[model samples]
Target: MGAVTGDQTVDQTVVVAVDGGGSKTDAVAVRLDGSVVSRARAGGSSPQIEGLTRSVEVVDALVREVAGVAPLAGVDLFLSGLDFPAEEEAYRQAIADLPWAPGALLDNDLFAVLRAGTSAEAAVAVICGTGINAVGLGHGGTRVRFPAVGAISGDWGGGGGLGSEALWHAARHVDGRGPATALTEGICRVLDVPSVPELIADLHFGRRSQGDLRLLAPEVFRASDAGDAVAGALVDRQADEVAALVTACVRRLDLAGEPFPVVLGGSVLQAGHRRLEDRIAARVHDVAPHAELHHLRVPPVVGAVLRALERAGADGGALARAEAELVGTAHAALVGGVAR
Candidate 1:
């Protein structure tokens, strides 16, 4: 059921799909029969995280690993950490040497989340992982997005942001600048340090890398589950933040009062941190009352595959088979796949 291009059939089509994110990249070469030809992974390639050159290097390396010497019917890339049109264009130009580049399409990774989460013509997706972002696609090709480039873009709600908040409250509590709470001692306990001053000194002097701070995100969830007031507040704030993004996307796309899906993706959201999930669901319901909540269980690369099939003009039946095949392989690959 592929497009009738000189009588070519669906089984003759090939697809090279890529999903690039802040923590890692996943590339898969899928055939029209819904069987995978190759799959590969590499480190983070987001231009917003690493510079353009390094981002290109990371993405290209993975693409080559999966797509070497393969003829393709189409290529689709869904990437995170691209903040604006210029950034997407720059990345597109940088990766133009791939065999299928002339026929390829590039899009934001949140769209991948949306595609992976639902088959609906209109939906919203919010990814809360190393960083946070959202995108909405409505009927008739309407699209909405955010800069998602940190506070300057007025965006937030990722593991990194949540971890930073946990540290901020703990530090403030130690200095009598904030309310006393379990986060102060919980942070010290996790770090195995004696007190807040010592930890602050180590962090300030670069003795402890600031990047390791994200490790505290799990501790925050744990504290919240244990009824820690400070941790609970931070979790609640994150829920509100994500719900706000989804609400904005829903409203902007005119999806209000509809039973459209609001897909959740990334480690922070997919972890099913019960309290956070409940809060986010409740918050989203408050605004978009009929929005259905879906957690993306398959890897985002499945979304990329779906896009590739769409580009190839494969029928919906082929899409269903391809998705199922990709989902089965995704489980096995995930044992070794690097997830953010």
Candidate 2:
């Protein structure tokens, strides 16, 4: 599509923005005037799990499908597994090689949450989805982030971590090695196994993928809500981890006393678990009284679109319009049965 300016017909700047996460990837083709032309969704495109080439292929396919015949003005990719500078640069080079776009802006997916949650100059975002990670933007463009490569990076507490912990406690309870808890029964029931032993056998014999364990994360919350002590402890620990991440970022950027936004996104955090939210709020407030906690309400792909527009030198009016349009489009998509 093209726009008419004065007596000239100029091709409208189109940006293909993508938010690729560990469980799903979302992409949108949008114009400089904040209009969404197309939207697409695909399965997880995490390079850590799908390999770099495969991950790139998945996102590229979605981008191509959304962009159609429009020449992209910019491509903004905020993806999971681009945790380090090296990884980000590698992806940047790969994206730059694509024929559709001139070049690309790449960063860890957590920044998508940061941008989507707030427009503040200084902010921190903690994502607790299938995995956990955080990023902080401080004064004078200072930034902070974690490797977030799982246990090797000392990362703990995500859907995967919580699920693994549930299984561990269940197995111990079954084998008389841990205290009795409802997770044993809850997990067995959720997985449709007759008992913990059978569940163990199924997981061990390849009847079920270990990754399915992440599905049990919600069971942890359910059990916690039902007054299961073990489950409650796990939930509490998850909150502590989230709080710790925010605290560390606040301290590192020396924003502890300054007003800043702490954006919380990802399935685990957005699940509306009362205890977890309460604990996180209480702990974060104790450390940084001026910090504001913002639970993201829109799909983070909106941030990708915003970043794309910003890169294109869009004015304030364009940004405001884009945010409004993106938010409305996201809501409509969600209501129409598209999963975020």
Candidate 3:
């Protein structure tokens, strides 16, 4: 949405871009001169997890902070948990009355991953953070995506899922219901518990929390590195799931024979775990032998800036400057300032 205050054309050069995720929301105000004037962060703004009203409040607060006194020429929002067009529309309507309405562009955060991973406007992006989702954009505006609404949408493999799988294997191993493996000790040690039974009981009786369980995901990778068979298997399964998603998107976009970028985001993939990376690369090569892999090292919010630059009619020089400047400064904004 474009905004004009009174007779003067507001500096349409200033852009407010946001990358809203399940855990946090990052907002930035970039001047047309290629400087990031302000950057702020807030809590989760995913309507699915935080509810519509709360999600709007969180986004509004962060955007308001970064925007400061500037009248935004463009506002680009790439968010997670907006699975359908309806959810996007709901969010659009909710923010329609804000000062930066008509010039706003809202999209799935997967697209942000696409932009963050490569300079191309069209590509495939897969996020394997808390959950797994993929998006593929082809030439001439062709688009393909999954619902990514969790198990009900035939989706699996994320940090949360991996953590739960580790616990499942650990509990079964302890009770003699499955193959015994190092995960029994590894998981218990990671959780600082005596045994799988006690850990399970703590989680079940509210002594521990699901968030604690989710933190076990990185431990799963570590255990895999240590040659824990159960952890290795779980990691292999995650690699399989990510590969399946990336390949499916490639096939859907019919880019099987071409050299296209497969941008990987989220902690699971970006962590650069060699075992998982090798398996995913092998599977992807099997499907699209020429597919390129881009592991995102910069914050995904860079995508929002890229999109905003495009919207602001920024020249190649300005675009390059924004990318270089934003890449350096956005990290400072990512720390703290998560709104309650």
Tell me the whole-model lDDT of each prediction, alpha carbons only.
Answer: 0.80, 0.85, 0.81
Query: Candidate 1 lDDT, tens digit per residue, 1-340?
Result: 3545676644534688889998899998877666677888888878877788998787777767787766677778888877689988888788787555786788888777777777677888889999898888889989888888888889776878987788889888988899887877877888788987898899999999666667678889998999888899889999999999988988888888788878899999999899999999999999888888887788888888877777777766656677667676444333211221
State which candidate has the highest lDDT.
2
Worst 10 residues of 2 by lDDT: 331-340
After superposition, candidate 1 runs with Cα above 4 Å error: 1-13, 98-100, 189-195, 329-340
Winner on TM-score (1 vs 3): 3
lDDT of model 2 at position 102:
60
Total clashes, candidate 1?
0
Per-residue lDDT value at 80 in model 2: 94
Model 2, residue 38: what's the lDDT?
89
lDDT of 3 at 285: 94
Clashing pairs in 3: 1-101, 1-102, 1-103, 1-104, 2-102, 2-103
Candidate 3: regions farther than 4 A off: 1-13, 205-207, 329-340
Model 2 misses residue 244 by how many Å?
0.7
**Model 2 residue 252 lDDT?**
95
